[model samples]
Target: MEERLQKIIARSGLASRRKAEDMIREGRVSVNSETVRELGFKADIGRDEIRVDGKLICAEETKIYVALNKPRGYVTTLSDPQKRPTVISLLPELGARLFPVGRLDYDSEGLLLMTNDGHFAQQIQHPRFRVSKTYRVKISGRLTGAEFRRLQNGLDLEDGTFVPDAAMIDEINPKSSWLILNISEGRNRVIRRAFEKLGHPVLRLIRTAIADLQLGNLGEGDYRFLKGWEIRQLMSPRRQNERLGKPWEKT
Candidate 1:
């Protein structure tokens, strides 16, 4: 299928559509070895020999989608300036410069989507996507029913505030409480902060699901590519609406 040059560049994960247009206008993009600065320039992605600043970019190879059952102690960044172990290091065999779609803090673990598909990545991270991400969290102490209700309502924290789309105690042990938390907001440390504001500290956090997608039996530090149908479902507007529902709807 043919697409605008900038669209292809955005899909390549180099930049967003707007940024790609800037690159094109700067005479950085070319088609068939000829510089193309026209904003409306189009090309058949599979047939065109496109280059960005003299480097060929394969549009077909631009998209890569993988899900990782992230283990603790790995940062969800491409490469840290501090040289911390990064998520991309785990996918050495993937042979593509993919990035984590959203993020999972070093101490948190579970289903994290990695991709080179810029538009897809942007869609997932965009607040408008409203994708529900589910996490299994183990907190240090048990909370009363009222305390749990407070979390569902929303909590104000020192750093910020947060509210889980859905939060419940799935399993209760003597010393630890296991909770299932679904959140639409991708704020940093949201789940942890919500519980902290309620005076409960999280000991462990594991992302178990994203929308209809589940981590399933994926082991720690293990990953698998998203199947074609799975990708389609995640991108479909209908499915997104179904997963997110309308604003103010209860989780």
Candidate 2:
């Protein structure tokens, strides 16, 4: 069956549908020997030589989904023009061109979903799917009860407002604090700014979970492939749509 070009790239795990669209627009994606920029273009994955930046994508024997406990300082992109270290640099054995589903900022690290299945990444990362993302954040200062409540409600940032799916203080120390923040929207550097607005600066932000999947015991910079059941859960529409409905759902 024919699928959208973005979908093809996404299913190959090169990136999410939206990011694949960006890659298309940037002339990094091509069909056979021609550059493709239209977002809705389609092709048969088995028959076409779909390439991204001149490298042909090989369809996987089985789509691979991975949960990476990323350590701080790696960029989430497949490759960076600046030659900065990236998430893909950490997994030279993945074989297929999988991509990080959403992203973790260069300095922020935690549970990062890596997959070769673009549609799965799309469903999980797309705002409409309402994927749940949980973060364990360490802040530079103490948070007031009112400030914590404001986070629970939502906070306006330089980009936009962020309404956390759930927000609460997980633990507190005299100099540092830990809070669990769950949100659906994958806004850039959202968690950092949410506390910044309330006079609490984020020191370290690590994602603890994504949807029903937890980061659990995965050491920093370590990763593992997704199991069959986990993949089925991700592909299931009923649960996915249910998670996506709540505006505050975790990403």
Candidate 3:
């Protein structure tokens, strides 16, 4: 059966669906020795030869899902061009290419999901799913009452409005303060950016959970395969909506 070239590449575990689309547009993907740059191009895996960057791809026989406790200073990518340490270096070679479901900043640490299943990655990362991520952040100073209310009501950032699902002051120190925040959107450095805009500036940030999946005693830099039941719960749309108390509508 014919399938979209990008979908085929993602199913082959070569890259995520989004990355595969970019590869196709860059003219790096070819079908039957002919470079095909059209995003809608399709081919049959069994009959047509499909190659990415000149390497033939085959359907991946096994799908892998992993939960990694990413440590600070490690890049989230499969490989870094500047020879920096990557999250892949912490995992034992499982013989399948696994890409990060989303990303955690290089300076932040915590639970990060990795998978060979492109569909799963796409679903979890898509904003429409509204998967909530919880973070424990240390900011330079405590937030005043007005500032806290602004964060709760939603703050207008240069990019868009950021309203955390939940926010609380955990502790206040002489020089810094700790806060717990939950947000469904995955904007780039959003937590940090929000705090910076509020004049508190994040000093440290660590993701503690994603949906029902928790970091839970998982040692830093350690990785474990996700349980079957956990994967099922994450994939269920009904369960996702239940967690947020409403269906997510894209703005």
Candidate 4:
């Protein structure tokens, strides 16, 4: 069957549908040796030589989904230009290429989802899905009640708001404190910057859970494939109006 080019790229796990659309607009995506910048372009996945950045993407394969207990100091990208270690290296041998669903920064660690199912990744990433992520953050100083309240009430960040769905101080000491924050909207450096804005610089941060999935006792750098039941749970139609709704469109 013929599908949108962005859909093919996204389904191939090369990029999100939105990112694929932008790449198309940027002339990075080509079909059968010809650069295709047109939105809503369609192609047959099996016959077309779909290349992104000059690399031909293989035909769709059985989707792979695994969870990694990411340790700090590993970048989330597939390949870092500065030559930093990426989370991709920590995976066990797998035939399908896996990409991190969202991201965990170099300084932060914990449960990170890796998968080759572009549709699955996109669904979890969509805001309407309401997939919340919880993090246990260690800060340099104790948080005042007012400061914690401000986090719950939401504060303006330079780029956007730092509104946590829920927040609580787990523990406190003279020198440091641990706080738990939950937010469904996963934005870059959101948790750290949110606390930083309140004078509580984050010393250590670890994601504890995402939606119903927990980091569990999985050791750092170790990963395990998600069970059939787990995949079914995540794919539930929490929200359906949005690619695989808006394809080849700007995010």
Clashes per prediction? Answer: 0, 12, 0, 0
Q: Which digits, one per residue and each the tens of the lDDT, describe model 4 over residues 102-217?
A: 99999999999999999999888877687878888899987777777787788899998777776667788889888777778877898888888999899999988877778889
What TM-score, to 2 decimals, does candidate 4 have?
A: 0.71
lDDT of each: 0.82, 0.81, 0.88, 0.84
> lDDT per residue, candidate 2, 5-82, as tens digits?
888888888899899999998989888898998888888878988899898987656667888888888999988898
lDDT of 2 at 13: 83
* Candidate that scores best on lDDT: 3
Model 2 lDDT-worst window of ten? 242-251
Model 2 TM: 0.71
TM-score of each: 0.73, 0.71, 0.73, 0.71
Clashing pairs in 3: none
Candidate 4 off by > 4 Å: 1-60, 238-251
Better structure of 2 and 3 per TM-score: 3
**Tens digit of lDDT per residue, candidate 1, span 1-251?**
88999999888887899999999999999999899999999998789899998878775564789999999999999788888899888886666788889999999999999998999887777888898888889998877777877776778876666777766677777787887777887878878777777777899999888878889999988889899999988887877522323222122
RMSD of each: 8.1, 11.4, 10.9, 12.6
Query: Could you tell me which 10 consecutive residues in candidate 4 have the lowest summed lDDT?
Result: 242-251
